[model samples]
Target chain A: MTKTTSDITKRTSIGAQRNPASEEAILTAAGALLSEGGLAAFSIEAVARRAKAGKPTIYRWWPSKAALLLDVYHRQKGETFYADTGNTRVDLIAFLESLLGFWKKNGGEVFRSVIAEAQSDPAALEALRDYAVTRCRASGIILERGVTRGEIRADLDIPLVMELFSSFCWQRLLTGRLDASRAQLAHLVDAVLTGFASKESHAQ
Target chain B: MTKTTSDITKRTSIGAQRNPASEEAILTAAGALLSEGGLAAFSIEAVARRAKAGKPTIYRWWPSKAALLLDVYHRQKGETFYADTGNTRVDLIAFLESLLGFWKKNGGEVFRSVIAEAQSDPAALEALRDYAVTRCRASGIILERGVTRGEIRADLDIPLVMELFSSFCWQRLLTGRLDASRAQLAHLVDAVLTGFASKESHAQ
Candidate 1:
């Protein structure tokens, strides 16, 4: 869609210099649109209209809808709590609780839209993978702390463990199970931390 | 979209009686469409055109696009292998290998679309959860065999473990990581079966 004169004036006043204020406005508008209407209501056109910024200006920075969605997701995630309670199981459980709670609040829908978008858009898929990698590394620190404290096996695959944790959360989020109880989260963490093998097998 | 005369004729001859041939034709057409175009290319209209049937006929039986997608998914899943070697780890690894292989082939895209569709459609989400419950119960049978063989702890939460396994596979599939190796799958199973507690924690 061609930019109208008003769009030009808006762009010049707010976004021409790539100022943080314009970026915040765009991100806020996108998040609001997503929260209000879900993925079906989200689009460059919608975001531009709501933000009063020109489409060309948005494209100048975000590149794709997925990128914008990812930013919205990250912005919300910045408020998520990651626990470090000096105990791996406890820390893991607390981390899960905070993460799931954040998701239940509103972050889940935003992230869900991102996942849905990734299914159809190559750029979205790439953005998703890259985001996953970054989150994996950051979250692996929990496992690392456990290793350091001798609470977890040093040889344990931290990345795999992180994937297991994330997969559990992702499945719950996608399947409308974000209301998983604290006890359930604890059970999951305990299962991961302590093997499920029968005592006899462990002895053997 | 209104049905043409040929559409009515095709529907009457093949689908009026809900014959096996027509059901198979519609399902086959749906699967082919999903496989070729992913979720974006899938719809009742497209399936009607491809199968030479009316959209009403397709909807009459499937009810919703999600229902149709679920059927297409189940049809492909029928070919998946679920092992029962009397060993939980072996069986789990083998099952993952077969499931991942199936996804890497074509099932991943179809299933991914189902997940994507569920994000925006309540009917799709319901269908997805219903399907997950069925799959979880069936797959839990593998772990039950382990319990019967005294290889697993009877007190263990079967449903939770099942969720872990499915969640792992779902994450890998959704993130384009369906190529996970046997070694990785084995590690995951072993972690679950043997627990990850440090030596000291186990002694306690």
Candidate 2:
């Protein structure tokens, strides 16, 4: 829920002395390998080889490939914010437009690997889950206001709402069609708000 | 576009006649590898080794790993359908509920790899894009009906809508929180439907 991408490993005990120079080298090497060949070409051995750091040093700091990737993403993640325009509609659309643009510009590849990495490693899965929820939590205020104003049903499941928002944007970014106009985003916001609004509950 | 998973080669003119028996073995082998280790462990060498098929054979059939994964998904894809029942709300909710349960039960791993593979490989990305569009096409009819009946906005961008729907479901499934209660899903569907409903456009 914090404003910035917190270093993923600070939560876990990586068991290595904090050496800024070594850490920088490892991250740089890993990032290069990931960029050049994606996940398949990424390995601790390859990273150690490239970074000229010992395998033990790398292992001392990070537990697995995914953990390393998580740190990379955390360090690299850019700003993701939603301004509190007081109008949920305006806030949601603007947040989504920026969110889509951000992912397309920088976060798509990292996001893809994190999601894929989560598939096999429980730790990675947990880290990715935490990352996603934390990202979603930033936009929580919008939902809170919508609920307060009765624009969104007070009983609305906020987490599910976040899931809907994230998934929608992720889908577009993943598929390379995220260049939706603000007007289009406006339409989507309207539908989602209408779905979450109280007026339609009885109708359903 | 196609009701079933079409072979990648069939579209590309691979020229060599695909032997059904070898094709079945490669798919089975690749599926197992993907399931066991996700994308990291999925490789032509590993698959060829396990299937006892040559590397050339796998390449002759699937131009890339993503394509192969797509074919596996097509072969193993479980039922995803919605009966008209005259209500878009009811039909969409049912479709999503089943979609969630199906992936939890069977499709999660394969789906994960295909998505991950698409991140770096242009061919795989194209395959994934095609697969997503093809999958979305089936659900397009639902939106069409909603438009005709004035339930959904007549000018709704169907492709973007589909991307939103798929991404939401996929993010949940990918994150493994797909066990959302039917009531919860109902809220999401309601929210999404409301977002796309015709009345909102006028309101906005």
Candidate 3:
């Protein structure tokens, strides 16, 4: 697992040789298209048209339509962290709160459309799965750190915990009830962390 | 939470009776259409025509397309519990395993279309949300029972726990890699339960 984490880290830098400017332009255009008209409006042709780049340039980088979307998901991951708040409970809550807020403030609309497309399209589902796995792996780092520090249980099921964490966001995202308020987030963290608490000590 | 569960159960039964026969027919047609054509091929007209029922009847029962799809989801829930195996760990695993099996048996087609429809269509998302909330509330009852039986932590975050459980299903549902084999399920349950374990009895 540790090796896998390092490998994922290494792969992140491998794709750096591609023209960053073109990739950025494509992502920006794609984001705009996604926001303006949802998945139906997102097309390679439109992305090229919006980015002022040729279709060949777009196709050269991304293998398919879903690949471009996944690039966006990857880029977003580079910007978010799971445990930066010092306190594990606070960090968990803040991570979720920020994610929910981000969804509502920036990512919600595009995500909704992505989810819709993933439902019906195999390609889009692949993109979403990639995003989910990537995010899970990233969050695993934080949980692993928590485990190492004895803040979280060492024998914890990282994938399941990550899945649980991710699901909360998905539930809120799908429902459009993404509230990042501290109180709500605190409650969520408290509840989840309680699951990690040792039962015997609490019995006393 | 118990009250909420009862309310949903009551609503479901009442809702079931209103158009049980027509609803079942529509769902059958809709499910078939989804299996064959995905979201692109799903439509009220197609369902109505296929079910041999009038469009007006479909509309009368379900206010929107997503609502019709949701009825299909509800109907699927009525089918059977995948595996009980007695142990909570095995039961959860069996449930997830069956879920994955169902998708594979259908060629990973039905849910793919449903997810796609859910992404772009607000109605679809709403239906998903309604179904999710209802389902979560129902699962919460199971958790409550677990708590009562001393199998699960009393302080577990009900909503968060449910989210975690559902997310595993969603990830598998979206990715078509629902690898809930016996070993994988054992690992997952150990990790989750360990993470949720109380501090006094850390030996397990």
Q: TM-scores of the models, in the given order?
A: 0.79, 0.68, 0.80
Q: What is the descending DockQ order?
A: 1, 3, 2
Write candidate 2's Cα lDDT for A10-63 as tens digits. Answer: 433455675999999999998888778877788889999999999888888876
Over B80-171, each residue of candidate 1 has an lDDT whose tens digit, in order, gives 46677777888888878888888888778778888988888887887677677556656766777788888877776776768878888888
2 against 3, candidate with superior TM-score: 3
lDDT tens digits, residue span B1-204, model 2: 223334312343333689999998999998888778876788889999999999999988777777787777666664446557777788788878877777888777678767766766788777777777666665666666666665666556665566667777888876777787899878877767654233533264
lDDT (CA) per prediction: 0.77, 0.71, 0.66
Clashes of each: 3, 6, 16
Order of models, best lDDT first = 1, 2, 3
Q: Please give, for residues B1-204, the per-residue lDDT of candidate 3 as tens digits.
A: 436645545334222235768767878999888767876788899998999999878777676787776666556655344343435555666666666676667534555555566666777666666766666655555456556656667766565466667666766777656766667766665666555333532342
DockQ score of each predicted structure, in the order shown: 0.55, 0.28, 0.38
Candidate 3: misplaced stretches above 4 Å?
A4-17, A20-42, A46-53, A73-78, A157-160, A180-188, A196-204, B4-42, B46-53, B77-79, B82-86, B155-160, B196-204
Q: In candidate 1, which residue pairs clash? A: A194-B195, A195-B194, A195-B195
lDDT of 1 by residue, A2-101 (tens): 2343432222222135678989999999989987888779899999999999999898877678877877777767734557778888888888888888
User: Compared with the true structure, what per-residue lDDT tens digits does model 3 show for residues A126-155?
Assistant: 667766776676676666666656677766
Model 1 clash count equals 3
User: lDDT at A87 for candidate 2?
Assistant: 75
DockQ of 2: 0.28
Off by over 4 Å in 1: A1-62, B1-61
